[model samples]
Target: MTPAARKCLDQLRTLLRPASVATAGGFRPPSDPVTSWFCRAVGQPGENLPQWNGRPMIPILQIRIDELPYVPEQLAHLALIVVFLDMEDLPFDKPHGEGWLIREYTSTNGLVPLPEATHDFKPFPIRWTRVEDDAPYWEGACALLNMRALDDDEEAEKAFYDDFQRYDQTKVGGYPTVVQSDVGVEDFVFQIGSEEKVHLAWVDAGIAYFFRAPDGTWRWACEFY
Candidate 1:
């Protein structure tokens, strides 16, 4: 990691509690199947690469129970895992290439979730544009959720393609689905605040963590890191 990148990571670590590190437990689909496949087709593996410090570019952030407002008895002992990718590692300018693969695993059992259910999670897409808005290598990814309503595979594919096109044209992106890992969180939902931004519902904690840019500035909704 670059000095600046390392500094940013350190700051992030300070803001959040310690992560519950575990191997992603299930066979989830790529947050962006088309994009994931494209990147893999061009050589990026859908599987997590060890090069990224033994984790996917998208690190899993676990929400501590004590920090939560009201923890259900069933969930009080279970930590919530949020998956995110580093935009700096993506190849935004390159066409038909693979991006990072974001996966979810259980720290308790080291089990990967079922691919079908995990793929259903909502994607959080963000585009980083130059001041002139002429650059194209914008970045985005998804969060792991356990909702079932977002499991519509067909709709998810369509949305992803449409969003990918927009990213190619306007340099914008957003999550494509809503269903996430099957860790048993029922209140999970994708909250959209504006046309350009949205966030994954971390209902258990009542606080939605938005993706901030490298400058530590908030992008619009959907406009996350």
Candidate 2:
């Protein structure tokens, strides 16, 4: 994504509160088929999980985007997103939404109560803290500076770039702190980190990055210790 076309994205800190946490966001779907698929996706049968695994899906967390500090114009349609994971065999190498999924809801009206979680991974309402916009890449840096590249000293510019921190945590936006492989500016969405407070762990303290690929398929990857 270019600076003129995209620029930077504002990020929000997504913190997991107590398991008994309550929030204004609705948990249940309004008899939506996709929502039903989410509830029964784990340890059920067919293609997804819940069949050979025989393990229930866990609710990692949920966020009310409409209640967030700010929503990018491109993602205004999203109203809520529920984070999900399985007992084992995550989607590290498999297709997306197989072992982990981020269920996006366009609206929260008329939402009913969700079914009971199969594991101790109780759903926690997310708390958001708005963070300053991050320089997504070199192009973003240029945009923030309001100048074209190549005017500054090479070493100084490199140092300036290095000084930009890669805020790695469960966040709503901003650039991803990739532990392995290269993640670009386009197609990258949000990420879910290992939060021990709510007993949420991904591949042993790894952070899971969710992306909407150019082909429109959901893709997920995690980085662990």
Candidate 3:
């Protein structure tokens, strides 16, 4: 690893807390560092940044970082990769029985509550975005790694288009079918923020983590699916 990568890795190690020892009954505390970090970050309420009127807006899912071991044999180096959440224009703040953005509500004829049950609408556009302050860290990390995103790769881009086409063809029904037209992955790395920081998300040993920007602090983690 380069000196820069080593320094980044060293900083990450400081955030990790040692796992609790196993008890006599074979009971062990949660030893997974990524899981521990994720629980704490998500458990606490994050600051909701300001929103704009015209351009698309995505919520910020605040994140932190943890230590990871290097394993070069498996091509498992800590490369920075960006992940994006697909966006859609869905109804929000509708009538009580109308159900929040549920396409299937047609059967109830816009009833606020379909007899026995009511559906709650969460805040619209349920994806996260990076804050303005953290873009430099992300950019620096990407420059250090020298990696390209799937969007920048010809094969990867073609695969995405082909898969999306197949997905569109496979749909059968009409009314409730989710035709997400004008829907696309918003790279918060560029829009509403600096282009330097690539919005990154990666899985290490099956645990999901994201680089929270301004500085690419790798504190947040979760299961991908």
**Whole-model Cα lDDT of every candidate shown, in order:** 0.27, 0.51, 0.22
Rank order (by TM-score, best first): 2, 1, 3
Clashes of 1: 25
lDDT (Cα, 0-100) at 62 in candidate 1: 28
lDDT tens digits by residue: candidate 2, 16-45: 111111222245433332232222221222
Compose the digit string of candidate 3's lDDT tens values, residues 106-224. Answer: 12122221111112212111122211111112233233333345424555434333422111110011111112221111111111111112222212212222222333322222322
> Alpha carbon lDDT of residue 5, candidate 3?
39
Report lDDT (Cα) of residue 4, candidate 2. Answer: 31
- Note the clash tally of each candidate: 25, 4, 15
Strongest candidate by lDDT: 2
Considering lDDT, which of the candidate structures 1 and 2 is the better prediction for this target?
Answer: 2
Superposing all C-alpha atoms, what RMSD in Å does each candidate have to the true structure? 21.3, 9.1, 19.4
Q: What is the alpha-carbon lDDT of model 2 when measured against the actual structure?
A: 0.51
Selected candidate, larger TM-score, 1 vs 2: 2
Give all TM-scores, in the order shown.
Answer: 0.21, 0.62, 0.16
At residue 108, candidate 3 shows an lDDT of 18
TM-score (C-alpha) between model 1 and the true structure: 0.21
